[model samples]
Target: MRDHLPPGLPPDPFADDPSDPSAALDSIEPAQPLDAAERLAVEEDLADLAVYEALLARRGVRGLVVVCDDCQQDHYHDWDMLRANLLQLLVEGTVRPHEPAVDPSPDAYVTWEYCRGYADAMMNVVEDD
Candidate 1:
């Protein structure tokens, strides 16, 4: 059979396999590099994440709960996972899929806005002291 693979691309190992998992997936385009503003935004998020983790972790907060737009559901990400995802976006221009925390306690996670407000309040208290 004639090879239809693109130049420099390896032959598909699952070409003749009936159970090829990728056969069900549409081809995904390469992720675009972050623009200057996007890069800045991600950097700021990373900095804020560090502050949030430092302040909240000691208070028994596990992590932040984000509302996923694609799935329209709440996704709980621990501090480590959040940092890893942000770093991945900075380095690879894409975030690898991560499994949500298993049986996460909703009460232990706060929204990003809550974190920001908490941080701001804490900063004000520190300045006033």
Candidate 2:
């Protein structure tokens, strides 16, 4: 049966093994390149991240808290890590998996909406002054 397998398809190395490690892993399709609109959106996110980091970091804000779709849990990312992840996504078309911060303080991280609101409020205050 293995000999008759289709061309270009490698024979499974663990066909006879009952404990194949990959058996439980889902096959992931290759990442597709970002379209123009997607690229623009990512660029905008990067810009917003820069401003958010600059404005919030001074006030003891550690980073952003993002909810993970895969795990359905909150993940805390520091400013530098978030920046690097965004850059990697822009260049590689995929974000690399990373371990979340160890025992991060929930109060130190804010959501994107909070950052946006804070930035807007800061702008208004500046304008008022």
Candidate 3:
């Protein structure tokens, strides 16, 4: 039976033992806990997200577009989708699956940095008045 498996793949020690107590343990993975700093960052992102949505949506902006580091591509997320993602991260401490907006127009979405700059400029204008 060992020869039937591909090279370097360990044969399951409990494959023949249906009642083995450790058999279930092999399939269970522990949930990773987030550190204090990571938790705080997620909270901050969620708060900033709400403000960004309100401020940008008023200027005919549909939503924010972010560049995926893993895939090296831009993903457009609608306002609700962004909220859900942030909330999920805040609550579950894990990143949900990526769900890019459907056929979003390039003109309607802006990068997070752009949104931050816009917010900063608006704040400065308000302070100057």
Pairs in clash, predicted candidate 3: none
With candidate 3 superimposed using the best TM-score fit, by how many Å does residue 32's alpha carbon deviate from the native?
1.8
What is candidate 1's CA lDDT for residue 20?
82
TM-scores for all candidates: the values are: 0.79, 0.77, 0.72
Across 1-129, the per-residue lDDT of candidate 3 in tens digits comes to 453332223354555777965666557564466679987887887688788888989888988888888999889877777776666655656553444666889899998898889889989999999
Compared with the true structure, the alpha-carbon lDDT of candidate 2 equals 0.83
Question: Model 3 off-target regions past 4 Å?
Answer: 1-31
Best by the TM-score measure:
1
- Model 3 clash number: 0
* Clashing residue pair totals per candidate (backbone < 3 A): 0, 0, 0
For residue 71, model 1's alpha carbon misses the true position, in angstroms, by 1.6
Write candidate 2's Cα lDDT for 59-111 as tens digits: 99999999999889999988888887777677768874555689999999999
Cα error, candidate 3, residue 107 (Å) = 1.0
Give the 10-residue window scoring lowest on summed lDDT in candidate 1: 1-10
Q: In model 3, where is the ten-residue run with the lowest total lDDT?
A: 3-12
